[model samples]
Target: MLAEAAKSQFSRDHSDHLALVRAYEGWKKAEEESAVYDYCWKNFLSIQSLRAIDSLRKEFFSLLKDTGLIDGNPSICNSEGNDANLTRAVICYGMYPGICSVVHNERSFSLKTMEDGQVLLYSNSENARETKIPYPWLVFNEKIKVNSVFLRDSTACSDSTLILFGGSISKGDTDGHLKMLGGYLEFFMKPDVAEIYQTLKKELDELIQNKLLNPKVDMQAHRELLSAIRLLVSEDGCDGRFVFGHQILRPLEISALSTKPSLFSRTESGPGGDNSKSQLQTILTRAGYTVPMYKTKQLKNNKFQTTVEFNETQIMGQPCSNKKSAEKDAAAEAIQWLKGGAKESHEQVNHMSKLLKKSKKDHL
Candidate 1:
């Protein structure tokens, strides 16, 4: 039926094509005695339909053989002879960026796309009314919004598919987490996953560049990369969620920095060290200011917490896993204080420091 439909100009309409494909898929999986099987057989038993079906079956088998996905004739190849994982991966390769996440404690799903927000499964989907969904992730063909968003031709996919085929990934706020789609989506996984993902991205990029440089070159290596991507997409167990990174919901904006001299310059040791306290102290000393002394408190959890009073009117607090880290955080806060109109000159800093010291002494 599919072959006949493909050859007939009348059956080449989009609706007819979609219906034929869906029916064929349903027929392949239907039981011989089932209503679905009967429906497909009755609808497609015409001489043209039968001829078309035969041609399609032959083409499908030839493709499987060419891809080395099958060793024998497809007509005799049973379901047991197929590699389900490889087949799903191949499907994912074409349906990438069509990934969706299941809603938490909800019956619906959400896609990470600009056009669609929440999507419902098509009534004909096997997962449409299932009580317990088999997979948390799904790869869908397309979404149409009528009264609400509807996912067409959806298929359940593993977590690996997202990692492999999803859009660009960037570091998340905390360690061992990654943000995707310019921070629209987030994933928490093993740190190794991040490392592996970076490596894979690099490899894929190089292959693309090579292909671009020599369009006619044998693409065996490129094909291998694609296969690797498919394999990665079949892995499981990476939790994901939709989130806005840095409180900026839209894409980030880039701007040139002001030409003004920075309050401090990074030294060889870097910003993560215990130098923040010393940096603050040096700035204060050079300004000839003695303000209220900064205070550091140790939390019950053993983490260091520090509070720095930038002026009589402004204060900043920071907490870190260790005393050194806490000091670094406080130092950064102090720089922002200066930049926010506290004082840029040494004389101004010294005056502020003196006022702070007197305030502390008076309180004592």
Candidate 2:
């Protein structure tokens, strides 16, 4: 359908083609996932309609050349695709009553109107705050880097982002375990969480370079950064799909920076409490990733209690208020609990205790 649209060259009787072009124009505006593919598609489809108009312009130019159509001495060089000149000619005719008015007034052409009526920038008040200078990241500005990770399966392939990292590279036994977890948690967690982290790192670099302190930047970079960060914190099905058998929500001890010390530790608050699973879920969601809660455990008295059940397991927690504090906790606990399990969780608990002690000593 796209190819056919791009090549057609006819001046008249293209009502059907025009209608399709218009329909696609409408579709382009309605869809949210309309990224590069959508833009390319709409352009390809619209090109066909332009070809039809180009055909008619050729005929019109032919009449003007060669001493003119009526008084055929020498027909003008009938040019096609001369939009600017053609538009000017048409407008000139309308302005001044002359013999050319007949040609310009013809129904075959109407200034090759744009598919979109008028370009609108920042239509709403909020949009004005959100809009940024239109510096598109074109191919000229883009640089691609190939990164890879060797999976324990002994099969090496090109992977843009590495999944397993740090000293605990996936060993044969761990790889098998992770594979099982992958199968179970594919829907609930993001399988490519490490990749997501790498992406977030890159996005953060970009944000640092172009976003953070730029006063002119109203909100575009903030939105993009928010999305990138969301993806960074989102649970990559590694745990949610019951991956690894009832994954741990918080990696044991959250960081010392936790303002309330209850963000993830307050089990009494319930899954939707101020420091509950819902709060953590919100932080991840805002950052750009979707996390579905499969289960919940109350954290009263700083200990997980009970086997909480839900009618549906797919619940998303609300955003947390103390993200920076949570971030500190996440970083501190990453190595402590992520690799090990109940033991590792306990180690993280101990580690936090030491961290507090060290801080107290520094103060003293």
Candidate 3:
């Protein structure tokens, strides 16, 4: 009804109507006095539309609190006092798994979802088409697929928001390395930072679970946890890399092996040194193994098994219910085989050498 009223009022004037709609829909200025709002107030056919918006905002807040979606009042101001980081953290809490990060390059700005593929930012977004984005991460409400995927009602966010409100946190392949969203994103940080992130994640999970079991839980405790989370996420001067899953899997150039021999060369220490995804890739490449490709086979129980193949030979097969887990299993098996092969060959060569030496002595 409000939309129809605004449309009818501005039907005759296209430019004013667009400006008014955008301002009304998008984030408003922090102050009570806004030139755009004033202009709309004077030109608008009725004051009821403005009143309706205010009422709607209040109702929305009420609903959020009642349903335990939020712990406290949300900041309306976009200024420094508004705590943008806190707002982002709260958004992450509610949005949880439906988050994305902005990827800006010379060519374009795209949003990469955790599990799903990349998506283009909605043209209506404030960050869209900007030469540079203010923040590296973004949390989106949802995605819609037309000709291509696009994020709707997206907001700029920071790494801290993800650490606090993102999905399951797991230890990465190496120390001081952590992965989120089932290895879709990787973070390299100090041991302390990793510990803090894990601790906060646990607290947030428990809080959310408790709230679900009983919405009438103490508001004081709820607010305190949110406060701690906000503080943790707001910390600065931390060093880490926010890497997309695809970027991690991107193959290294063949020429890079010569320049970075230490990274790609087979280790004398043994296979268990580092069987990480990248290391596995290096070992495979060195052994003349082609880039591993996967084929999915559906089973009778509606489950899937992923098979990793190299040069038409099946290196490993993984049976799991989900595609992601199955793929991980297959890759792990391939790495194990590559690592074990080296050890077996070393033993075989040593045994052959001993036999050759003994036979030479007998002949002499």
Number of the top-ranking candidate, with TM-score as the measure: 3
1 or 3, greater by lDDT: 3
lDDT scores for all predictions?
0.50, 0.28, 0.54
Off by over 4 Å in 1: 1-39, 42-81, 106-114, 204-235, 238-364
Candidate 1 vs 2: which has more lDDT: 1
Tens digits of per-residue lDDT, candidate 2, 281-311, equal 4323322234432332434444322211121
Sort every candidate by lDDT, greatest first: 3, 1, 2
Model 3: per-residue Cα lDDT over 29-124, one tens digit each? 412455545545544434467557768978987887878756674663223334545655666667767666655433344556755666776765
| Superposed Cα deviation of residue 261, candidate 1 (Å) | 50
Q: Better model by lDDT, 2 or 3?
A: 3
lDDT of 1 by residue, 97-182 (tens): 77665533222333334346556877655556444344445677888778988777666655555555556677766555676666
* Model 2 per-residue lDDT at 296: 27
Off by over 4 Å in 2: 1-343, 346-364
Rank candidates, TM-score, best first. 3, 1, 2
Worst 10 residues of 3 by lDDT: 355-364
Model 3 misplacement above 4 A: 1-37, 41-53, 61-81, 106-108, 114-116, 211-227, 237-364
| Leading candidate by lDDT | 3
Backbone clashes counted, model 2? 21
